[model samples]
Target: MTFPRTLADLSTAELGSGYQAGDFSPGEVLDAVAERIAACEPTINALWHEDLAAARSRAEESGARWRSGQPRGALDGVPVTIKENIARKGVAMPSGHAAGDPQPADHDAPITERLEEAGAIIVGSTVMPDWGMLSSGVSSRHGITRSPLDPALTTGGSSSGAGAAAAAGYGPIHIGSDIGGSIRLPGTWLGLATLKPSFGRIPLDAPYLGRCAGPLARTVDDLRAAMTVIGRPDARDYSQLPPYSGDYRVPDFSVSGLRVAVHTEAGCGMPTDPEVAAAVDAAAQRFADAGAQVTRIAPFMSEELLVDVDRFWRVRSWVDYHGLDIEDQRRILPYVARWCTAGADVPGAELLRCYQSIQTMRQATVAATEPFDLVLSPVAPVAAFPAEWPMPFNDPDQPMGHISFTVPYNMSEQPAASVNAGYTADGRTVGLQLAGRRFDDAGVLAAAEWFERSAEIAAPERTVG
Candidate 1:
């Protein structure tokens, strides 16, 4: 089928304008996105399900509402995708794990409910690695969700499918959850803009420390659009911040005079790939170029901090794996299985100590970056690895080594993002991590938004020639 790329590739802002101006109908845009998925999915394997029949119905309703001049919300008629772990009524959330319960969720998760209320037509749920653990797309349940930039490369993970879908133009917006670097890691690998807002900024179905659901979009404006809808307090999450009354879409913002810290080393991860390091340094230079007082900052994360958090998560995932029947446990991706299984051997006292180490990391990260208003770092030390590899190095014994730059911010409860800053040798995108103090999500976003508008080159080459 020959669908025009215009409708599928338009950003949320463009869609809104087109819808109001009668340039196109929601149904037409939906068709374009469906065409995009049809063309991209076979090679990418990004989608877990497609609900076009339902989306078509919603698009029809949205079109009629648009014609009458009364739309449901700001995002009325926009196309979006939510990750598989986010429960939607009548759909089973396999969460990329073969052994996961296949029961249909009785109702939509809060993010889904919010998206529906915002009038965005959800095209479908995307894939992820088993149990949302790995930072790569090699899933035991769903197989590999490869990058749009290069089919041979991974999209990064556990937000794997959402990243791939967003990069592939399946839709303008895709919802993803990030505990460590799930959102930003994939965002960087896929050359998209993604945010892991301050903890509790976007209420989660299971709101634990450092875990929040966020969005992946082509532009920060679209990211703000998604935030305006889903970034609210939910009764389901006791940890949610007080309802955010501030406007997410700012008319203007600046980093002028703000203190900026450039962190080149995460202090514990694989040595930053030379290309990635150069890109990050160039990104930080942009802040200096814009009148922000940028300075080099010492690495705050240590081997102890990284190892401690790794131990805590191992025990945490171990508990989940142990609860599943032995046969189900055997179905998990072997890398993830071997990684978490060792958690069973940790002594009770060490387990508590491991948990406390998270608090220690939180304290250290918060203190270290407190002197600066913003911190710029690398999302992952390297660019995208092979699609078939479970981790960057393909080793379960040291799966977390690449996350040192990202995991600290999770524990610190700070808002952070991954914005495409540069390219690898083969033209793959490299992510430059941007972060701000707890609850300063808007500032972090503004910095990212600024980069998007100011970049001299296109961040990713996803356009069809």
Candidate 2:
């Protein structure tokens, strides 16, 4: 059984190296990926629309190009899944809602175009919760995605499918869109290395304050490679930053002399579980042992900021939900429907107050961490919950309680990543959030890679069922 390792289980760098050295072709890798998906997808429900036949043809073409020494770009043959929300041409972007368009998209999203142009094979689109709102994988259109670590446990969303697929060995790389803690929350829960790059680092056709697409994989190297492809400039997004001239590779670097701040208390939302806090403390110690100056930081987030942000998002979801016909409106997930209903009667002045609170949060986050070169915190305040729960608290009145640690960075436009830090008492994985100053994606990634090497970053056992 151990005669040969499955190519699907290889890291992105390993797959690319194998391709360059002729150890294996993209077609062979696609077959291996298909095998893995078949074994896991039925139980995990990690994917929605898949055309394996089309993917294999693309892989064959990529393999031929690789053999001819003319691979299209750096990620030439790697198999990858895009979050269901990231539009793919000719594929329906239900985006975890029944109200979403049934017709195929007319054009690819900017990141999708970039990845395809880099010759990456698109495996399929992963599942997500309604409107990519919830932190758990309780999708309406797509069924719940169980964590690969334990089928009974949740895979945090809105990047639910990408996280599950990455942990379950569907491929070496997967792309996800995160606003708030979507990518990092699930990454931690599923024990994957995920990066939610600084806003605009990965261009989005439809950009928002905290929304951006990023990579979730088993290794930082894969994330680095994904950044190389996804970070390319795309004019379609007017909000995207000017082309980044810096390298995307995680530099061979040291954490020595870095000023790193650690925070366990959020001062607002869900309190960090003892086991989760211990894991974060342990990650902080890793920095201390590596000669980095690790210091505890006070919580800049507050109950007002958390509630305001949640309300602001609720209004948004309410608009989208209300626009749907009555039948389609009823089709929304009950949890999401109940949550967004609060926004319907919201006063305009109160909505403006909510927006201002986001500004307060942004300013507070920057001011609090300005002295440090990097920041570390728990990705989520708790460990994995049941797979079927809509969120950690599962309360319509207060659904965003778990995102306090990760949301500030998104509001502040800082580059943040989640590395599988350690485990809870019962052995569920924990993620440590590494955040750097706004636009310092490279620095954040380099430090994450450094920690990735030092930590025991274990992959889940293959028994997903």
Report lDDT (CA) for all predictions. Answer: 0.88, 0.89
Looking at candidate 2, the ten consecutive residues that score lowest on lDDT are 456-465
Candidate 2 — which residues are off by over 4 angstroms?
Answer: 1-5, 250-252
lDDT of 1 at 171: 74
Reference-based lDDT, residue 25, model 1: 96
Report the C-alpha lDDT of model 2 over 1-465, residue by residue, as the tens digit. Answer: 122358888887788789989999999999998998888888999998896989988998999998998988768889999998898999988879877468888999988888888889899999999999999889778878898778899999889999999988888889998889899988889888999998888999999988878999989888988898899788888778888876675456779999999999898898889999999999999899989999999999999999999999999999999899998988899999999999999999999999998999999999999899999999999999999899989788885889999999899989999998988878798999999998889989899988989876665554563
Residue range 1-465, candidate 1, lDDT tens digits: 123456888998899899999999999999999888888888889888889999999999999999999988768999999999998999888878999569988988889999998889999999999889899888888988888878889899999999999988887899999989999999889888999999988887777878989999988888988999999888998888988887764456786898999987888968999999999999888889989999998999999888888888898889999999989988998989999988989999998998888899999999999988889999999988998998898887874899989998999989998788979887889988999999888888888888878875575776331
Cα deviation at 445, candidate 2, in Å, is 0.4
Q: Give me the overall lDDT of model 2.
A: 0.89
TM-score for candidate 2? 0.97
TM-scores, in order shown? 0.97, 0.97
What is the alpha-carbon lDDT of model 1 when measured against the actual structure? Answer: 0.88
